[model samples]
Target: MGRTLVQKLWDAHTVADLGDDATLLYMDRVFLHERTGSVSLKGLESAGRKVRNPEQVFCTMDHIVDTLPGRGDDTIMPSGKDFITTTRAAANAAGITLFDIGDDRQGIVHVVSAEQGITLPGLTQVCPDSHTCTLGALGALAWGIGSTEGEHALATKTLAVNKPKSMRISFDGELGFGVTAKDMILHLIGAYTAAGGVGHAIEFAGSAIRSLPQENRFTVCNMAVEFAAFTGLIPPDDTTIEYVHGRPYAPTGKTWDAAVDYWRTLQADDDATYDKDISIDCADIVPTVTWGNSPGHTVQIDGAVPDPSNAPDANTQTSWARALEYMDLKPGMPIEGVPIDAAFIGSCTNSRIADLREVVKVVKGRRVAEGVKAIVVPGSSQVKLAAEAEGIDKALVEAGFEWRESGCSMCFYAGGESFGDQERVISSTNRNFENRQGPRTRTHLASPTSVAASALAGKIADVRKLG
Candidate 1:
């Protein structure tokens, strides 16, 4: 019997069989952010236990740090400075690597980990954030944990987790122009609903997925949470090896050769079986947008908002009605022309350098529409530097987009920063639940290009139609 990649990684990391599906798994790395990282660090300190492997832990400020270029520890979130200060003091005292505000390595936890080679294939990584699975794009078995679980991992270097069922989503065929990984995932969620992959860890495969650039795979895996999957993965390939090579923390010399050889063997066998299997043809997917609150409440860019009366069940009908009301959208209305008051182009989901480059392409010679407030935030300081070097930041700023520092800004209204109530926004960030960006803030999530185009048009515009 051939084994799936999940089983291979699982068996290798299993430290003990606790029975009842729970196994004590060795953890290779743990990344933290200011918002929840402080909670775990503070808890560990209160318990008088030191991190078993401080070197394996890394911390950065993201969730609450101000993304303004000249910003300091102060933030839009009330008492946000405390999170930054506490996390810094705790991290330094514990000897863990801290990417302080001015550090070049400072960025979102997931982005820094990948760009620095801290996350590698076949390793187990966890963080106190849901989007931790973004690292799984590099073939690592990574997922999010609550602050308590994070504390346990920090102290013991292991976590007792119930193995999840395995599922495979195969993307066959070539992607069309202007159709991105963001659209592909949105289309899948729309077809399968948000809860489709519940209790499963997804392995994204097939030619279309392999065709994506390494970092773009992060964009695809970033939305795995929207599929309700435990995590998302893509086995390391030649491109993966090349991307990992020369990264700051990547193995060197003999270690590098050995690691690459091992990563090459991390794929699922040809005859491997999975609990569920789904096939999506890339040709069938187009630029998509979410008209409702959930990622699943999506339609083609050219399509109309769904009428709740056509829903398959009463619950679904109710959900549809509520989403439409909150979104201020009318049934049968075209999604393309929906008015937007703000546009945000940053988040763990789609804020990489490649994403920024795409944004520049769409809005380079244009200005933001009058009355629209648009901002471009890089995913990390390193990305910000790279984009600046390429003049991407200049183009964005000149085109009327606010070029801000890197952080998870405006992705959600976690702290004091928000788009205010009842404002409609087209964003590159994930999720559009009611009040996610602000109280009553209506969010339509899309690709950077789409966000850029929508910012120019002051509506939910499609990138395909941009001149």
Candidate 2:
């Protein structure tokens, strides 16, 4: 049988097998942000250890930096400024590249890395954030690691990890209008529940995946963690190569030619085998929305809230009941027109330039609902500039969406800004767990376009209904 893409990446990066499923894999790149980067860097300092290869390490001021324009080190979270300063000092001492505030290249770690070509096909990347799998869309073996593990990778350039079982999820057929990668992912999670991909490295493949723009592929891969997967990847293709070519940090000249040639070979063979396989027909998917505390508690925009009595088992029934109570939603209630207090349209999951552009298309001629507080944050400084240059920012601002600077604003409430307890928010973020946005805050996750429509209606309005 032909080897799987995961096997190829593993074989190429494996230094040795340590028995019991553990392998010492060479790490091609290590990324960090302000929140957890400081902890790892401080650990190295205390141990008087030097990075095994500083060139492979990079740090950015994303997680804790305020996204407000003209913002500095000051932040609303207590000691947030200290984290930034400490990371800056340690990153400088370690000789690692630091994308500090005001750096045109600065943004979310995942966004900046992809934009700068720091993440490429057939490489290994890791960060201390669960969504690090976002980079795996380029066919890299990327995943999250704990801070202590990050320290070890910094000092050794290798990590001991057990190889995860491989699975392939093929999205077939063509997606319908208003259906996006975000909706497709949400549908997958809802169908299989949150633990569906546990212990597996999911490879998203098939006609539908190939149809997406390279950036939209990032959206699909970004939510892999929510499915409980070890990581997620999409083999590189012509689309990916085109996206990487000529990037700021991408290989140049002869190196570029060679890289493309190699990346082209990164796809799985036709007869490759996997431990598990699944197929979802894209034509059946619609604009999806989460209805409760978990990403798995999702329903189609036109569907009704799930009734716990119809759940498969007692445990699920109890879980569904709790989610409904927490969300202040009733079983069998129509998901559309559910009132909301706020809307957020930015996060590593859905804060790219394309996401912002899609939202603008929905908000251009409409005003936000009178009682709604809506905000739009770009994923990176570069994305922010690009949107402004295209008049996207002006459109959102005029529609009453607070056009803010980059950084993961409102994706979660850790930044000292939150929608407050008991507030209902329709957000274009990855997670909707309890208090994900703020203490006791109820969140409904959806695509940027859906968020825009909901904000305009001041309720859980479907984008398809807007037209």
TM-score of each: 0.99, 0.99
**Residue range 1-467, candidate 1, lDDT tens digits:** 99999899999999999999999999999999989989999999999999988999999988989888798988777798999999999999889999899999998889899999999988999999999989999999999989999999999999999999999999999988789989988999999999998899999999999989998999889989988999999999987889899999999999999998899999999999999999999999989989999999999999999999999999889999999999988999999988899999999999999999888989988999999999988999999999999999999989999998888988985346899779999988879889999889999989888889999999999799885
Give the Cα lDDT of each candidate.
0.92, 0.92
**Clashes (candidate 2):** 0
Model 2: weakest 10-residue lDDT segment is 409-418
Give candidate 1 regions above 4 Å deviation.
none
* lDDT score at residue 267, model 2, on the 0-100 scale: 82
Q: Mind giving the per-residue lDDT tens digits that candidate 2 earns over 1-467?
A: 89889989998999999999999999999999988978999999999999888998999988888988789989988888898899999999999999999999999889899999999999999999899999999888899999999998999999999999999999999998888999989999999999999999999999999989988999999999999999999999988999998888899999999998888889888999999999999988999999988789999999999999999999889999999999999999999999999999988889999888888888898999998999988899999999999999999999999988788878886557788889999999999999889888999999999999999999999898777
